[model samples]
Target: MTGERSVPKPLVLQDEDARGSRLKNTDLSDSFLRNLKMRDVEIRDVDLSSSEVEGANMSDVRFHNVRMENARFDNVNLTNVSITNANLAGMTIDGVLVTDLLARIDPDDDI
Candidate 1:
């Protein structure tokens, strides 16, 4: 798909103080999110392609079936982040605390 794909509108990200917020089927494609602090946010079946997420503090976030291609995570602190069954091609992650981010998929492998 060219450009940003269609996704669910206006997902409420839980703050750092608010942990374990249940979320599902959200679309965050081609969006710009900066300086967001959240905890235990579950994002399932979301299209997060071509989005710009910089300087965000996302701890204990779970993403299932999310497409994060061409997304930017520059200077973002992502501790305890779990991403499953997601396409993370061309995504840039720079300057962050990614102690809990485990990439199950390899970007070098052909799909």
Candidate 2:
């Protein structure tokens, strides 16, 4: 088999406080972001394919024009988040029960 692997892109964090910061227009392809606490963070026009986000707590997060293909979100707590025009294909949220956290996203999604 050919060695064709997709590497995850790096996450550009705003600052130490991560207040009013946003990770927009980033290219995080196939990267795994785990155990990170994100608050009031906005992700727009980013590609997060095959990324594993586990044990992370997020609040007031906004996703606009983001690409989330084959992303894994397990054991993650997303309370009061928002996502718009995001491509969420093959995303799995097993073993995690979400509430208002994912309400910002869509409920009638096929992913």
Candidate 3:
């Protein structure tokens, strides 16, 4: 038998403040972490795939080489966000396709 186990769900937190906390190498996959003030927290090497985040405020967050495929985002604000070296294929903003917009500037796209 394989030693594979399912990820456990997270505890529901309501009106809790966890700011100025340092978390390193934490595994929070398949967890339900929703609605609990988490501002200015330093998170490194954490897995947050398949996580549901709604009605939250996030500012000054930096991500590197994170996997976010098949993720749905609704009513979220991203001010001054920077995304680099990531796939933007089939992504649309205001009915404008990202791939289509890049195609216009790079016709041949040999660079």
Candidate 4:
């Protein structure tokens, strides 16, 4: 007989409080988290590719060494966001290329 196992059901966590918990080396891909209060949380070494985040408040959040290739942000606030020494190649703002804008500001500087 072929060694084929049936797919397991998804784990559902409702009305659960996981505050102050540390989840290390865990795979939580394709998980649905709604109405979660995750303020003052630090996420490191996590893979969030193709994750859909809607109506979330991420004010004062810091991201370092994050891979956001082909990622799109809509209707988000960036009032006091600071990006330094970041590769903004092919990155756009309001449908305008960031590199082009930088070139206009500083023509001699290689972006």
Candidate 5:
């Protein structure tokens, strides 16, 4: 068997410590993560589409150049969060359109 490649097995880490590790070009799709202490972690160029996150404490997090189209967030705190230069088209807050709210705030300004 020449030029044959072997399939890699799934890597499992239970009760293991992997702090201060850098992961690049890793495929973690369909992976299950529970009870993880990922505070002060910096993640960049990651694909987390169609992922379900529950019971997460993500306060004081910074997001830049992130694409979150058609993403739904429920019961998430946005205190003191600032968003600028974002595409808010077709976005809503509490079943009310954001563009409508902005229109109410400043009727003369075009949205």
Candidate 6:
């Protein structure tokens, strides 16, 4: 069965303070959000494909059913970050694949 996807609208916000704001039923595809800060924000059922976040602080943020395909991250500080039931296919850290290293350490990781 084929499912239809609803494309999100184009959004651009520069130097805007959207703290404690609620955004519902919106498409943020191809949006450029620079210097945006969000505290205690709730984002559900959102698509952030090809989005770039630089020089920002993110804490206490929760994501459900999110897809981060081919996403790149660099020079970011991460503390208390927990990832479960993830697809680490071709995922790398410090120019090394995680699955490959794990396979070597364990030789049979069936988890």
Clashing pairs in 1: 7-27, 8-27
* Best model per TM-score: 5
Please count the clashing residue pairs in each candidate, in the order shown: 2, 5, 0, 0, 0, 1
- Model-by-model lDDT, in order? 0.49, 0.50, 0.68, 0.88, 0.90, 0.71
Please, what are the lDDT tens digits per residue for candidate 2 over residues 1-111? 479897665655443565564455555555555545555444444444544454454444445444444455545556645555554443335643344346567668865
What would the TM-scores of all predictions be?
A: 0.33, 0.34, 0.58, 0.82, 0.87, 0.64
Full ranking by lDDT: 5, 4, 6, 3, 2, 1
> Model 6: how far is 51 from its true place, Å?
1.0
Residue 83 lDDT, candidate 3, scale 0-100: 75
Candidate 1 TM-score, C-alpha based: 0.33
Clashing pairs in 6: 8-27
Task: Report the lDDT tens digits of candidate 5 across residue range 1-111.
Answer: 889997777889889999998888999888999999999999998999999999999888888999999899999888878889998999999999998887778666675
Which residue runs does candidate 4 get wrong by more than 4 Å?
Answer: 1-9, 106-111
In candidate 1, what are the lDDT values of residues 1-111, reduced to their tens digit?
A: 789888656655444444454545544455555555444444544554444455454444445444444444444555656555545444334543243233554678785
Superposed by TM-score, candidate 2 places the C-alpha of residue 16 at a distance from the truth, in angstroms, of 5.5
Q: What C-alpha lDDT, on a 0 to 100 scale, does residue 13 get in candidate 3? A: 53
- By TM-score, the better pick of 1 and 4 is 4
The TM-score of candidate 3 is: 0.58
Report the Cα lDDT for candidate 6.
0.71
- For residues 6-83, what per-residue lDDT tens digits would candidate 3 score against the true structure? 666666656766556555656555556654566666566566665666666666677777777767666667667877
